[model samples]
Target: MTIDGISSTQGEDGVQEFDVLIIGAGPAGLAAGIYARRAGLSCLILEKGVPGGQVLTSPMIENYPGFPEVPGMKLMDHMAEHARRYVDIREGEEIVRVKGGERFEVSSGAGKYFSRALILTTGSTHRKLGVKGEDGMTGRGVSYCATCDGFFYKTREAIVVGGGNTALTDALYLHSIGCKVSIVHRRDSLRADKHLQESVAERKIPVLFDTVVEEIVGADEVTAVKLRNMKTGVVETKPVNGVFVAVGEVPSNQLA
Candidate 1:
């Protein structure tokens, strides 16, 4: 038997003919495509933005198998390209609505691509600081992962936003790596574990209590952070090479 094309049927009678419509071009989505195509099923990939999803923004990934070290952006591109060799791959499209019945109704920006089954692989988005230029300068200097962007600021000063264990740990890591670290917390009290907090304190990482980053100052890259004393209402500028938003990050599973 031969594989049929996805656009062959109109689905006007509301009957899906294709085997699968994978939403998202992430690792999970592309892996599904490989399996579906190998199983001789018609598969189509629907992606809202550039293919590879949020993984593209990741700086580096060393935990994955085979390759000892690989950039997240490069890995995503390779996955998308490899999946295309087995199935029809499309990009830069979003599924606004999905209706399921005997078949499925997928309404996208480009058009609807119907399939008998669906694989939802839409991933998560990073929880931003909501500060101006923070979203725009992500990956440029503003990062969430100390493992990824830490090496870039070797022997340089960096600022971490948060008072919890993660933020303190990040500060310690940077401090150990010869980088001066500053912890800016929104509240005066730290909520980190006792041991971790003590470790951070022992390191002598400057703790700016009752403080929050009002603004991240930089021209091309991270140059400094505008910190605000929540109690005194005083604003101070601290020189730094990079700013890590350890406040938090949320998965981009809103679509899912």
Candidate 2:
């Protein structure tokens, strides 16, 4: 089981082999385990959690080219410390079961591996607005991460459901951290881009547009948000202590 320090090669029925398993540790499975260990092979990765998947909930990142800004968990912790110097990551595991042709096996609660190539990268998953109290108010104030909960809603008050580009970049990162943001949008223009709708109208924020949240009120945290509007069918409620959501993304692929 010693990954990273190497020694976990077994394969004469002992399983746990690998000339490249990958799965997902994000950043495309840590750049396909550093190009499958610089093309020499061995590789591994795995990772069910903890390895910067959704760019670790991205707070700042000026389009990764040469780190013009950098933050998404410090650029995935420098790409998982440069793919752990050469593969074999293993964080938490979670493969479940795979089994393909000439090699592949996989499984995972804690064992069975083998792999003559199987790279999934498994990314996306953050698109829920199925309304109604949103799964018991998600982490309390309900959030799909505005930089991982936007500093606990800085000055407080938040909304940002969706209008694209990750809900206007999480309403300009919850109005640049002081929170008090808004933006509901069930339509009525704004699919973000045009410099993020001109930086959310030069930072005036507010927005609501055609609205539509319809429930996520709160009892142990979020405190308000019922909205409706969609061309004046009206219905209000909007107090807000945080909600964020960002509406889009759903392809973790269920281990395809």
Candidate 3:
């Protein structure tokens, strides 16, 4: 039997064992670590990217319990710091394989980790629009989550790129949050359900049908979206402070 990417047979560093091995350093993973440590259990957390996951990229958070508004990274930093007092954190280690049993074995590019119990807090990744500047402008002006960034654009213009339920929901939510909200769908009509469609209309959220995002514009933050009107073959730029891509998410479950 092979683990996700590691062979069943042992290799380089053998296996580094712990009472519990938690994969991912997001909020869930960190919280789990805290609990484990509080219970006097030895726990270790492995993270492949930023310790906060997507929260690290979030510019502002409005509804996180205590604070009315806090920087996403700052909140995560506080979590990481608190969790660190109890558990060990390993960042930049990409876990590729996992073998679960009484003794679970996990392998990352860095090394092998073993534990009596394994917790997967592996999060999901937002699907991108693949337009030019989208990658470079991430967290600047291009965002994939409306809920996380909508509050930052109060009374400001923002665009949603998608046609599904999520896209429609984001558009309506942005409008409700005081944004000049609009949606740009590649298809002639939205793929969202009828109820969502009615809500968009009722909310007066503009829909740009048969449109594709050609580029995400901004230098430090999202400034606008360059859109191609498929029907008219016209390209235009819409000024905005935010661009939310509601294209769904891919889970970090390759090892599951």
The number of the candidate with the highest lDDT is 2
Candidate 3 local lDDT, residue 78: 97
Candidate 3 lands at a TM-score of 0.60
lDDT of 3 by residue, 1-256 (tens): 2322222233336656677789999999999988887776667899998689777765566669997889788999999999887777888999998887768888888888778888999999878777788887777767777777788888998888899977887787788778988898999988998988999998888899999989887778877778998999899988888888988788978888
lDDT of 2 by residue, 167-253 (tens): 888889888878898988888898877888898899989888888899988788888988989898889897888898888888887
Which ranking of candidates, highest TM-score first? 1, 3, 2
RMSD of each: 6.0, 13.1, 8.0
Tens-place lDDT per residue, model 1, 1-256, is 1234434354666444577888888888899989988887777888887778656755555568986778778998889889888876667888888888887878877676677898888876545687766866777788887766888888888888888766776787777778777888899799887877898878788888999888888878878888889999999988888888777656655544
Question: How does each model score on TM-score?
Answer: 0.61, 0.38, 0.60
User: What clash pairs does model 3 have?
Assistant: 4-97, 140-221, 140-222, 141-221, 141-222
Would you give me the overall lDDT of model 1? 0.77
Model 1 / residue 128 / CA error / Å:
2.3
| Model 3 segments more than 4 A misplaced | 1-14, 129-159, 162-182, 185-244
Ranking by lDDT: 2, 3, 1
